[model samples]
Target: IEERAADASTPRAGPIPPSQRSDMVGSAEGVTEMAFDASVLRERDFRDTRRRIQLLARLPDIVAGSVDDEELLVRVSDTLLRATPSASAVAIVRANVPEPMGAGDEKPSNEHPSKMKVLHYDCRENGAQQHSVSSRLVTTALQRRESVLHLWETERNGGIEFTAAENVDWAFCVPLRSEACAGWAIYVAGSRALGSNWKELADDSATLADRLGDDVKFAEVVGSLISGIRQTSHFQQRHLAMRRFFAPVVLDALSGQDPQSWLQPRQCDLSVMFCDLRGFSRTSEMQSDQLLLLLEQVSAALGVMTRHILDTGGVIGDFHGDAAMGFWGWPIELQLSDPHSDLSASAHVVASVLAAARAAAGIRMDYAMGQTEFRCGIGIASGSAVAGRIGTVDQVKVTAFGPVVNLASRLEGLTKHFGVEVLMDHASASALQAWLGQDEFTEEPSPFRLRKLGRVRVAGMKIPVDVYQLVVPSGGTQDLTDSQIDAYEQGWDEFAKGDWDSAYQRLLELPAWDRPKDVLLRLILQHHRIAPSGWEGVLDFPK
Candidate 1:
């Protein structure tokens, strides 16, 4: 009989006549007729469609709520298991995934990221991964870049490798990303618990698509989400390390993925800081037998300096044996719309310089080199510099270059000459004073005492620079009190005015142990307590 006889689903304008709707009950003249009903089949299909709709509805929430890849996979795997009651197992696999970024230099594995990394595999009660058959299904799906359906009975593995899991009679696999590495896929397998056929509950009419409704689309959606997450995670990890050097805007540009535009040569105002260990090199030389121990101590000190600079949002640069350098204001300062925007980029520069000085003062490690503490000398200079990838064609680095960089280095060297831990060039000193005049700085007793230490002709430079000392008394170090500082300045004014006798008398009144006083006193004694002819008061540093 045609299904139209059984199907009450024929579209018609009016209800059928009573004779047409009624079943033919008896045989007449060797002719028999029977009317069929399909309400049971329709009801089954309706329930299946509703179940799939419900499962698909829950997936968006699942993807959104998942915090990590593992969590995402585990939750989605649970959903898959619940969706297919006849399924003995479901699995998510990353097939032939390429090695991670920056792994090119390593000796590769035998398969070279081939086959798979099984993300999730769930079977029935007391279940284990059916690797033998599952591997085949994953490979087939990924390699073909499409779905694979296999009947376990027809495709048997007679060799050592088991062709199928126990009681898993049939399986289907769907491809995720075909071009990602090799690819990714998901698979579902039927169990003998439901007998050899799906028809036990399917009324002998169920098809695979009918059995696994919405699964293909669901898996595809999940695959796309995973790909996005993977890409994002890679960038985050890469840039998190880079943040220790690059500015926020530079990092943003990098994340936007066009380095060619912004990373080119940039000339802009920058604050450069140079720090060198005071006694570390001498200690290392003296304790040659314990060189390893000395090296560790020096490294720890550098680490401390590096941490402070990074915390203050500066970029680390050259490593000159016993020293390290870091700077601020790179790749041009885009005005950050932060709450401190009114403070301006100069504020950032000033803050970074102070932090560098504080870092230098705080480093008083005791390596086994005599009884001297491993102190550091820091120099800070603020001016214009070119900030970018600077080097020859083959080798390059993200660094700042210019006279400001040299001045920072020179000031660092002058720290020993001045008998102070930190020194700054004229421009840096002016910036510090400018920032200190602000309301924020006046509220607290400044941690560092800033003083103008007169102009000096630095070696290898024709132009003279006004030197300044930044003093932070720690560890019972002898620092000039306000009274002594006032007294020294009075003497310095006289000395600058060519009244050596007056300067000499005033300087002697201060403590003998006052190193700044001693340095000035020596300068006077060298000039025979008299200003030389045409003396301009700019003491030239002997090379």
Candidate 2:
């Protein structure tokens, strides 16, 4: 056997057969013919020229075959045997060794055992009895990093002779290079049925073997790209989950910080808001069998509230039976990024919650025909609280814990008693006041109208807390008329000073639309009761 490069431009011994002239194997039917650069070539050059033509006929199949890798390699080996005619069997082996598996300072050696598997082949009757080439020779060819050949002959006395094998008596091994796997392919050819020209067949086989190496590399690259895309998709899903529960500015900061450190439990200054639908229990009981209808009405009302809250950069914490809890200024710093932004964040929280409450109160649904419109009450508080993750590992929830949250809930409950839609504790009320008092805010007419409700010590609290009532208009910033504001404050001052007779007469003189009539009415009823001896105008509500 012999090995050498096949000249690319050469004429075949005869016209290529119709069966082998398919487009799959590359069409040679066109008119262009190659022109040789040299004149007067030698005998060996002529043989190389002929060998090239035969190999070129099979080029298209190897490069663009529709079949899989195994089938493509089998076709290459079978084509080589067909070209030789003297060979009757073939095998296409795949390399299977791990690449660079050693530890530090360890180097690989040539003596390492070769890992290989047969990809495809054609075995003839006599060829099945013995291997045309031994595995050791295959390893030796790989170590040498090139093609090597061996030939033997049967002696007249029935003993084998160590002579160069002719067309029917040779074995050859060719290395197929690839970085994807640390091994080489072995093509074993066997037979004894022809005149000669074994050297040309060996040369053609070596050429096809090299191209096969490239095919393996291409597969590896495709596999790697798919893996990378899948990993990116997973990260995107996690990013979306976090975004759903936090604001964009928070996420921006979290991207650079370590989650393990920030997620630990700690105290943080935050503003918490709680909103609940008033008389929802009675409403649900009335629409008992039509739960779906109730859900549609409630969802429509809540959807508006949710959108406004999210727009204001508030993180929704939990959605209990008929209420939603939300907060701001935790999991990250709440520095004033802009001039108005200092109080704007808290102001937004109040405005959004009030807007939602008003919307819920005014919603009219077809399913609730003849029923009264739904109304919601909202309460907001600002203070320091312990904030962190809670629940089991698999289903953890991020939430805030402390009196700040509890007070917000209590304030929501007081909305019904005060006959108001929205209420807030001192911290949040102060922030709103600061922004509303600004020139920018005063010039535009504030989005909210504030009323100072008298101090009261709520249940479970030692200190009396100052509360305020907020009136949010339906569309834009439109404060109440002067008469409406004057009437409520005038009546409140007299009531708080314990002058029951004057307070009763002042509230009685104001028009019904001057303010919420219930506030004055409730005060008149309480006015007749005897107060505790040390009362400093603070109402004691133990419930």
Candidate 3:
């Protein structure tokens, strides 16, 4: 055995064997030339690059289903710590989390709430290099608006102790931008094993940074996803909070759209509807001991009105105690028949009429069974009105201006006098008729039945408006028959034509259930069965 080993250990005199030849070359048949991208970055598929890429590719899929903020942070931090060989520990801090809408900006006496901050961390319990993250690194990255690479054992990481390990001991910080947030950033640190040469790695920090570029970009992309999810959640939270103040249509129109362009004061043909609870004063007096219960009932009734208004795509303009005002035709979301036509003008009034009638009928049919009495009087008027925010900077509210708004409120008052739940001005009544005349407008028999109450001048306005009862065929209020409608119209025409005695007699012949005619009967008797000179049948209400 010793003699054979001595012979085998002897050096060869020359490299004459084919297997021992030094010449080595690639075959050109099936190969293509590819150059290194050193000018931009050193292109190499080494361990760290490939591992980070794999982690990045799998990242979005991992965090894609995470909807909650804390849950998302957990998924991202945990995935980075576990998947990336270089990461000793990972920390993602969502800085300056935005306040949810309304964010409890309530009165001082009210109980205010605070929003929770989102912070998540993941660490390997190997008790080695990457146990805790450095705060200096995070601040520096945010200040520079870029990712930063630092050695773990540095004077910059003061007060926090770190033990440099043989495997992975480096820190990375990547700053991120998020919509609707104060600030967002991610901190990933640790080393993957190739060889741990701390001095050489520090000297070649630039190249190391280039190698970590994909990981930096991955952190940013995840940060962006977190930001987007947070923003969407922010919007949803605001949408729900503002539902107390705004209708869904209003919120939908304003969402992702410029509020300055939509809410700026503008002149438009507006159809305004005003609704008020009828027996609120009486009910409040009777239920004063149980005010909370009465308040809940009022809220429920307003909810019905708001639902109807929003269902018709109307803007809920304002709420005055037991009253709510809704309007359309601001040109924001109006779909006009003609491109040059006034936004929603005449046609929109017909829709407003429908919504107002529906709201009144809904109150009587749906709310009458509740313990709280809910009888609403709704008035609809259509004309030019300037619509927009009508308040100071400290306090603002959406409302409309112009004579039409006042007229609608007055018509609402007239519902009590006329024994009707809904009423509309001449403009709205005419538009309803015109819309009903069009074959395409209504496919079913309209629940709305209109009967003229002749011209009447309410307090605070000189011009007498042609009043019409918006009779719902199945409302909680009186449902007039065809004969009753004919009788009312016959007397109204006679009254409009200046035949007071004959008109008064026919109106008296109608049943007392036709309470709308009672006002006419009293007016004729006010003038002693004779038409007063210059009295053109305008029943002026004394204030």
Candidate 4:
């Protein structure tokens, strides 16, 4: 009786084809019910979905921290693959530029290798080929800016008819976009079992992409903030250095030293010089790889020159990229019995830097040869300027803020317009009159070109001030005597004419000990700005 009852209670239909299903026992009863509770199933599904979303959300932050493009792509692909288990592969393709208004845009990475592993295509070697599902998905996402899902029924033979029918059952493509940029495309693919969950996974993946996009935006903001902070800090530091040089007593107090030594500032005689490099931006553009390297070399040479200045009792106020500014006098002014002796020192500094520039240019030739060259124009002005610590304890800055410093900078700028290498104002020329002695100097008429100083007006002062150029002869051993130096200057002229070979040849003739060699090397290396072989001798270029 029990066996008969059991047989009657059991459903008659087993797992069978849909066409063969029995109608008598009712269709619903034919299939076995899932043992799990609906609530538990729902909770598990929600948790899984959240986990997937959370993983995708963190991807952009991770990618942004990557040092280079290759790492960025790899990180993106890995994150997407982990999110969707059915995904056999994932890929991201980026567009070079945004689509124009009312026009169809083409994918920049359409030729990239697919990320799929099942397809026996060597993507790493041959790049993203047609047989790769990952490649197609990346391309599609980049073009559509939307998610595309393809299943086995829709895409067979790895999306190629001639290839063997390899099963890539499902694929999901999602576009990643950042402000003003189309970042990449994320793609995932897997087998039929994975294909069953394709729609749901696609929804989850798209959500993840949105989250990652937000992270990218945040990273950019943070990066910009950091850069701004760095610039501000650098400016403040320069101000502090100037203060320390001019007013030791004030600097001591700011650093928590004795306040008793504070005394009223007095007018002091000083020599101010401004050195500016020409064509720095153009040089940077021409030698993109070696730009940083060149900057470092120039900075190092400047560092050496600065040391020379300090040794000679000169106070360096500020050093900006391709610019060095300093003065003598104030805090403690140089006392010269001859009075004309300061002129020799000023000339020495200019000559030393010129030598350093030549050496730098030579070093660059060893790396990239005659690609680029550098030239610097210097202006010197000697007069009285107030020097003191000009800020509160927390924000104190030592600076020589007066008309003399401004005049020096103006003279430096005027050098280019006048076709002169070194220019000096009337006061500096008079101060160095004894040293000039009709041998190493030339006096040119002041071409009074009026200059606008923003809003302030100087009564009777013209834009271009009276300036004199130094005309040192060739083979002079005092400081500016070297064939290599001449070669450096000639090379710069050739470079300006787009005669790279001639420039390189002239630069190559410069001796190893030449100062301009260093400057020329930096200019040439700017073409292929590779990372320095080691961290030694690196210096920051002025902006």
Candidate 5:
């Protein structure tokens, strides 16, 4: 066995072989001629070059809004091959990994196959590699980033080697990054048997790669833009919700309602109250930051009061900076069996509102100016009035438009004239008399004065309206009356008739003592029905 092995390794010397000499000479001449031809060929085929450019230019427009990655790859590969006829096969690897060398161990050749082969290699994993061979001349072009060209020759060992093996011949690998999570690598292989110049073909392949990359970049930008748009939409939605929570009245105006019809022509019984902070303007002017702090405290106090009012079934009409207006009977009504019952409810509402305002004022004074104290004046009235959406479409407001609202404001102003924290008109005072508990008022009552105008008439009266200043603590009052309860039920009936204007007017007229405002909202809601299209439902007013 040792002797045999030695003989196998030993070189065998023989006589001059004519056949081998002829073959060697012929191959050398052929290679030299081929090299000359390759050198003379230009960088790229002019016709094919133009076609590829045109195809690449269209890629961006085609790929937009497309979700199918495979379809995108296939279309891109087809465009590339058509643009450059020398390309024997195009393989697109849509993954981060290196591409596999062959299709299932099938050895690739430098000769062009009978048909062009296009393969889609899906490499979902991180490391996937792919390899393909086209014409030998083009193979040498696969070096650096873009293009390569090559020439193949068979050796005595029955193995094949490429010309200019030092540099990769005939290969183009272009990396692609998209908006999606994965990246792609496009591979184009040239054939040596086709007898084409690989250098020119390689350059063309490089150009193709660049064009495809641009397409990928465009797609990525589009995806990012879409994401940004969605984020903006979400932010807008949240903003609207916050606005609605803070200002329900403002929101209602924007929600589409006819201002003139809703506000101008309707009558209902209602309880109205006006509250204003004392010395707020002067304090705010002195220190703006301090004022803001004061405002925040005031807002918190108002929030608590508003919640209380809502819990007791009252509707807040409007708030103007430091001032706020609330109503009981306009939008809803209460059922009051007795006149005294009506008076009791009004007393409670007025007391509750004034107490809340004072609490808020005190808090603001304590936090903003330790020694400084704050106070608020409130006025209460019960009467018939109209309230609804008012103003032009571009600038609309939900407002109570009636003498009752004016009277309430006038009474609030009278708080300064009368030198008292709270004052109620004779109507409201009478309605709330029972609910005032043990609190008393001075018998020598001054006339209720009006702002701009001097005096005004009130409901259920034959003489001038007499106003009373309640001598109650910051926060004390009685429950509602039976007549006020009757008023709430009547107000609700009007609200259900799709007559918000009349409902509000009649509800306001019911008596402050009725606690008409506290129970009015609930009654209105109970009796009122909203149509599917959001219109107010018809009311069956009881006779």
Candidate 6:
């Protein structure tokens, strides 16, 4: 019966197939002589044909409203009931399907067929009966995977009527099957004798069910795609927020790794650089108009330094008044325990800061009584430290915590005492030396010149640390000459060997602008008289 109903459907461009049409007409040839009235059949056919036209006109609306699944299903149920002749109730139930099968999969078991969730539309006074009958019809249609029609007459109070639900005498249950969904659509109508139109009604109901199934499946697919799109959009927004707080390398690593794990504190080897304006405090005491101009110049200088740091894949940790702190090898394993990477990063940072310092020194503002020679100091240190995010949720910062951070800051402060513009610890200096040693062209003059200073124990440390000055030749702005560097090194060797008088004479032979020579002169004057015992020239800061 289901197959015949399916075959009855013809393309809108042509009439039904001749053979099936002839068979249907021949089966109803003797309708007038049957037990049931023929007029009832004729009237049913007329009404069903009209209702089908109405349903077809509204089919597009039902399909187009598929963005909202619940709304679309409700409208579909209502339309089915309207098109079904004399229907007292209608129900639509979606099938519960397991995962899609693969080629090698065996047939799935139906022992625990999914429960039916029926959407019922009750037109009669009895809602409970409508629901109960709908459930049974849905289950039957799913079990058979076909259309099921039942007709019965109940003798109640001398009148024949169906007694199962609202005295319905006829029930039509058809499975809604499509590539995207499986379900059932059930229609129940009151008792009426139909001599010939019963078969036609069943065929029409089956056709409608099949076509509607495809539409519903398409709607479901569209809805699922929309949901997935929304979820992806949300994830992208969160990723952008993470980018705001973390460096690009860290963000890339976190993109593949877990963000929660990356946020936790960990011990890592890092290179930290601290840069501060040398005379910002004194400059700040000037009149507001002049102070504003000076600050603007300072900002421009920092911008240049910032580009250098970022270009070398460094992360700007934070900014203090007139100063900036940045670091490398964090959030992700940037340097990866490689000394060369640390040295390269530190060298770049020092070069950038020195360039900014040089630019600041030439600031010519009318308010400057003349050209204001602004000087800056950059201090770099490389070692292991604890790195991660810190502070409350509302105001968090990504930075490192350890002696490396402290020593870097202290080194920046010492740049003034040593009369040098750029200073770094032994680790950075050694790494730079190793990196420079790899250079094949020794005659071309190395890109950077490294000068070792005497050992010094800063205010907070128990052991002394060796410091070095980094100098880069600006564009035609002549750095230390080779001869001058040689002389300074020889003098420094003398000073380290405890020959203060010889060191002073050798240092005096170099240019007076040399910062190391200035530092050695100061040290000699301070310790010439009170010679402390076992003093190996390790300068200690006063508490």
**TM-score of every model versus the real structure:** 0.57, 0.54, 0.68, 0.33, 0.34, 0.53
Q: Which stretches of candidate 2 lie over 4 Å from their true place?
A: 1-227, 248-264, 332-337, 340-373, 392-394, 474-480, 513-523, 526-532
Q: Please write out the lDDT profile of model 2 over residues 279-315, one tens digit for every residue.
A: 6789899999999988876776566556545555566
Model 2 global lDDT (CA atoms, 0 to 1): 0.55
How displaced is residue 147 in candidate 3, in Å? 4.7
The top-ranked prediction according to lDDT is 3
Task: Report the C-alpha lDDT of model 3 over 412-495, residue by residue, as the tens digit.
Answer: 999899888888999999877765655554787765678998788999999888989888867324567778888889998888
Cα-based RMSD of candidate 2: 15.6
- Ranking of predictions according to lDDT: 3, 1, 6, 2, 4, 5
Number of residue pairs clashing in candidate 5, backbone atoms closer than 3 angstroms, sequence gap of 3 or more or interchain: 91
Each candidate's root-mean-square deviation in Å? 13.9, 15.6, 15.0, 23.5, 24.8, 15.4
TM-score: model 6 vs. ground truth? 0.53
lDDT for residue 309 in candidate 6, whole number 0-100: 60
Cα lDDT tens digits, model 6, 82-130, are 5544455665555554443355644322232366666545453454455
How big is the RMSD of model 5?
24.8
Clash list (residue pairs), candidate 3: 86-192, 88-190, 168-191
The numbered model that scores best in TM-score is 3
lDDT, residue 463, model 1: 90
Provide the global lDDT of candidate 4 against the true structure. Answer: 0.45
Where in model 4 is the C-alpha error above 4 Å? 1-266, 337-372, 391-394, 435-464, 474-543
How does candidate 2 fare on TM-score? 0.54
How many clashes (backbone N, Cα, C below 3 Å) per candidate? 0, 0, 3, 40, 91, 1
Each model's lDDT comes to 0.64, 0.55, 0.66, 0.45, 0.44, 0.56
Candidate 4, residue 334: Cα displacement in angstroms equals 1.2
Measured with C-alpha atoms, the lDDT of residue 487 in candidate 6 is 83
Candidates ranked, most accurate by TM-score first: 3, 1, 2, 6, 5, 4
Model 6 residue 383 CA deviation (Å) reads 0.9
